[model samples]
Target: MTAAEVDAYLAGLPQDQRDALEDLRKRLKSRLPDHIECLSYAMPGFRQPGPKGKMVVGYAAFARHLGLYPHSGSVIPLIDCAPFKTSKSGVLFTPAHPLPDALLDAILRLRQDEIAAGYGRRG
Candidate 1:
């Protein structure tokens, strides 16, 4: 899916959720210059380059909070996600309390390394 799909997803959310996810979308775009922006698993996400490219990250808005999905179960556990609610595959935050840049950077680095090493992908 294209960015327009992502845009539409964001547009349908409440104002707070929209702003929060939009902020994340911008951050992801800035960091992942070589990655393709698309909608995956019905979430706005970035994919690695090429036909075989994997999903690097994804974000979505929920009724109570926003979620940042690394698309890998192991990625979230490897980082310090204090002060935010987290699950095995996603980090949950609110518009008032967004994920920090450093945390996002760490998540990106770890996920990139995992992708490079083929950790979560099947051959």
Candidate 2:
């Protein structure tokens, strides 16, 4: 999604939830800079272009939690170390819960590696 689209979506969320997601978005942008691309995928997502020109990272907002989708298999280790709860392919963190910086950093690093290796593409 475009930045405006992301802003509008965030605006519609409950205040605290909106704030938390927005904060996370800002952190991702600052940390990854040109490495991350914002777009809509069922919900707003941050993507990393893969070595094979596919999407490597896909993050979105769910009803009760934020969903972090790391398309690379290497993300498994980081997901395992995540302080917040996760299921299947994503990390699920609530607005009331604090952001897991270490986990986030690890995720960013994985995305960087995927991009360097050429694993996905931005939609």
Candidate 3:
């Protein structure tokens, strides 16, 4: 999605939650400038664009919880190495929840690996 679209969506959220999600979005962009691609999926998703197309990594929002959608084979294993809680296919963290920095870093690294492996092409 365009920056404007992202802005509008964020604006529609409740104040505190909007602030938190916006903060998360800003931090993700700053941390993974090269690997990050922002677009609207079920919500705003940060993905690794592949030759076959984009592969989603994760998405954060005010409604429920942040969802880490690790598309590569190694991501789930990496997140499992961490102390954070997760479900079958994604890591779920609530709005009141603190962002799992270590897990996020690992996820970013895994995306980098996918890119280096040529599994990700620029989108």
Backbone clash count for every predicted candidate, in the order shown? 0, 14, 1
lDDT string, candidate 3, 3-121, tens digits? 57667777888877777777777777777665445564556656544434455465656356555665555556555644456755556666677566777777777766766677645
Comparing 2 with 3 on TM-score, the higher-scoring candidate is 2
Output the lDDT of residue 102, model 2: 78
Q: Could you list the CA RMSD of all candidates, in the order they appear? A: 0.9, 3.9, 4.0
Task: Point out where model 2 deviates above 4 Å.
Answer: 48-56, 120-123
Per-residue lDDT over 17-91 for candidate 1, one digit per residue giving the tens place of the 0 to 100 score: 898888889999999988999999999999999998999999988889899999999999998899898999999
TM-scores of all predicted structures? 0.96, 0.75, 0.69
Tens digit of per-residue lDDT, candidate 2, span 10-55: 8888888888888887887777666536564556656544433345
Candidate maximizing TM-score:
1
Candidate 3 stretches with Cα past 4 Å from truth are: 34-37, 47-56, 71-74, 81-83, 120-123
Report every candidate's CA lDDT: 0.92, 0.68, 0.63
Please give the ranking of all candidate structures by lDDT, highest first, separated by commas. Answer: 1, 2, 3
Off by over 4 Å in 1: none
TM-score of 3: 0.69
- Worst lDDT window (10 residues) for model 2? 47-56
The lowest-lDDT stretch of 10 consecutive residues in candidate 1 is 114-123
